[model samples]
Target: MPEIVGESLAKRLIAWGVDTVFGLPGDGINGLMEGFRRHADQLNFVLVHHEEAAAFMAVGYAKATGKLGVCAATSGPGAIHLLNGLYDAKLDHVPVLAITGMQETSLLGSRYQQEVHLDRLYEDVAEYNLMITNPQQMPGVVDLAIRNALIKRTVSHLTFPNDIQIAAVDEDPYAHPAPGTKPVSLPNLDRPQLAPGEPELRAAAEVLNAAAKPVILVGAGALHARDEVIAVAEKLGAPVVKTLPGKAVVPDDHPVTTGGLGLLGTKPSEEAMEECDTLLMVGTSFPYGKYLPDPGTARVVQIDADPTLIGLRLPVEAPITADAKKGLQGLLPLLRGGDSGFLDKYHKEMESWRADMKALQDESRDPIAPQYVVGVLDELAADDAIMTCDSGTIATWSARHWTIRDRRQYFLSGNLATMAPGLPYAIGMQHAFPGRQVIAYVGDGGFAMLMADFLTAVRHDLPVKVIINNNNSYGQILWEQIVLGYPEYAVRHRQPEADFSTWARGCGAYGVKVTKPGEVRGAISDALAHPGPALVDIDVNPNEPPMPGKVKYEQAKHFTEAFLKGQPHKAATLATVVRDKINELRS
Candidate 1:
């Protein structure tokens, strides 16, 4: 058979080191599926339950391995389904390439079935978008899509019409050129090394050296520069405040580490930010400006590879547009050691904060505190475990209770703050690193959104442990309404309480439901020990709110107003809040 465009595309992806493709097959891409079959030995196609899950899996894969993640779909709706996940990748700045199918060339503008203009649809989400109309455009388009996705750290897209997918290529796209003609070389996939200039480094160091109390804020951008960030923090005696995505950048047990910032943060972190005279932001434009120091209160130095993100969230006195690792390396040598007093203060505060948190993880709680469940997992999980979290109150528990140490890595929908990616992300991480343990820390509401994909894990025999905080309510939304002085409405699950464990068992996976606090640890331990996919549904107290680090008077007033305004479970919520505060005092 002649070399078709689909075959050439598959071959090119193999050449670029893409071993797996996460997507569902459809008639629109029947030719492409055939090509994938021909190269099945070299490339693995992960058949996902939904196109959205496929896109999220690609995002998860890219986030885990720092490589180009690829996902494909059919035309129209399949292509439309990829938008949310693609947007997640775009906002998080992860590299993902999306391939879709188009209607046949003859059907162009004929209003045929599944005839969607994918190029215009993807224009906003993709860094590079193209629709291949000719067989000759195959090699260059594929190369450019992968190249742009990697270099720009965003989504790239390509759509091929059904007729064009199987069309024969007339010439060798990768062959050596004739005399006086240029050769077609594959695009380099490696990212270019970028470091701050000497002047920029010196300027940043000067600001650091001049400050009496400096706080280093790290984000996802600093994930690969852990050592460099540590060196800088130690040299400057700065308290390390992590953004949620940067939770693993520094171990929670580190002397200067103060846990995460913003709503899902520790008191020490908030205090450090409130008091710091100089702020050094690494690879994060943490969006909550209220959580940061006042605009002119502190001098700021930010290091990021994306120039567009520098000084975005705060005013910066020194902006270094370079890779986090390289920028920190250059800035470290010029830094002068500051007094250890500031770090010492926060270290003591962190100890108190941790003690208070430990008090809340009481095993005596009847409904089983979510904190207790996560704390147990933290104690039992492997040193190199990978954690994928869903958005909502579960994120609160994971951020506060899970201590990331050693080789443990955490992934979440940081910029998008979307739900349902937890399970899909876990599946992707398990695929990327088969030997390492992967767990999805998701809430009941979030897990319900994508629970069908649990079957994917079972089918593949990927042992992904899922720990669900089964509160039977939209816990985060409930808390948000209360905090805003509004009575919670339609937040609680109206239907019969979902027993996720039974569903897991039906899907041919290990399953357990833990209602009592005493059962939490054992259930989690067993799930982790299972050889295949397992799910643990632990019923937790829905009334327990994820309180902010420092609850302001306004928030307190709102809580009172919400209760007075006839919020459901008002008595239970007030009791829970009061008990938690008393526990904090006792600690």
Candidate 2:
């Protein structure tokens, strides 16, 4: 029987456990589209409004499930559009496979209409990038790309020419053997784990055991090592501070969770970092060196799989090169508990910080404080909800207030920190787990950027809920200008405010707008209860600023001067902040 190369490629991918692919159709790749049609029974293709969204959906899928996510695009412009999302996967260390089409082999050097130098374009972003030139190389190359992505935890790219995709091939890569033939052998795909040696673990333990006040900083790499991380923390009586990407590793409600530490983090975590004598960093290369204690002020002991990342962000005294889970297991046996007095002090501070957050949530305001909206969302969300957040000021609210309990999955654009990923991430999550609840917490600026895809969800019948914090501005950028002593310009959305509920309904989905503080909970409940895709546009206060963990005197002076220069209308917001600070002090 005759076989097409694209068909063999698709079958090999299915064998490697890829069930779904996100992409758009274009004229450059009629061959790959034909393969999709022929293999429709085995594989599902999710159509997206834009190729960029398709790539982000793949990233979201990879992040949600620790497996290889697949995305496809046509030649030239279509492939270029996928760079932003692919970089998101690259920086965050998620496994993703990108398949793109190319111009026909016959048009090699003729400068065809839609040709692109895809190999060079994807060079930096992909760990494995290649163009399939031979029909016989079909199944083998596909297998190699998948393996490389999974093992390296990076992006892999494979470009197939339009002519070669449908070219005839003879042998099936998975053909049955003859009577006397030997059994076929395949590469083992099991994950590799490395544990630190005795001396290395002992060295790390000795460093931690001597310190008076030690703290644990966790990152995305330590996600699966939650138990081990907590064990080490408990053994040392140290506080566990999660990085932005590590928030879900340990729930905020955990007794030792100090939330996150940085610009978008909690005060308790900043305090822990400032006061600790030793910083035991677990599977994280947190980028903000300034937020951490000075080199001599705190000794650093870092554990990571990659040796190069050991002291990338800070000085290290003990470097243990191993997987987070295995490294922690090796060190746990040699560690001794530090002073309980240090743990007691941080615990009380954490409690006070949480109480202050709750008080802010309870305080009602005219435009509906976003903090209250997030607090209510924490209460109403399902136990296993998958929450996807857009990058911006809304990220601050999500980090500060969203309580991740019941092992709920929280995903964002982590290192790349791109906008317009929230909706696509939620869509991908819903497609991956049809029964589970998915929520996209988006801000006004970000939601408008990709609202075109709201129709994609509706068309696919995905019951994803979207909560829009409609502050009508790029709130984070405005705050940055304020804190940097620069006047705000070109940051606010000059257009009139959009009623997102009306827009959602126009796109054939359920939509509601909540303007009052009292109506926030009911609106969210109703949106969740809707049978199809729903959007809840809440008019959160635009004047509310995102408070960082540490505020310097210069930043305060800049903020005050900026407010006096052009933001005098925000005096009421300043008053509200002062009142909240006084209340926090009294508490």
Best by TM-score: 1
lDDT of 2 by residue, 422-536 (tens): 9998988898888988999999888887788888999999999999999888889988988887767777776678899998999899999888898999999998888899999
Sequence-dependent TM-score of model 2: 0.94
Task: Kindly report which residue stretches of model 2 are placed more than 4 angstroms away from their true locations once superposed.
Answer: 170-191, 582-587
Deviation (Å) of 581 in candidate 2: 3.2
RMSD of each: 2.5, 3.4
Off by over 4 Å in 1: 171-190
Best by lDDT: 1
Clashing pairs in 1: none
User: What is the Cα-based lDDT of residue 568 in candidate 2?
Assistant: 43
Q: Given candidate 1, what's the lDDT at residue 211?
A: 89
Compared with the true structure, all predictions reach lDDT values of 0.91, 0.86
Candidate 2: residue 200 lDDT (0-100): 86
lDDT of 1 by residue, 203-225 (tens): 99899999899999999989988
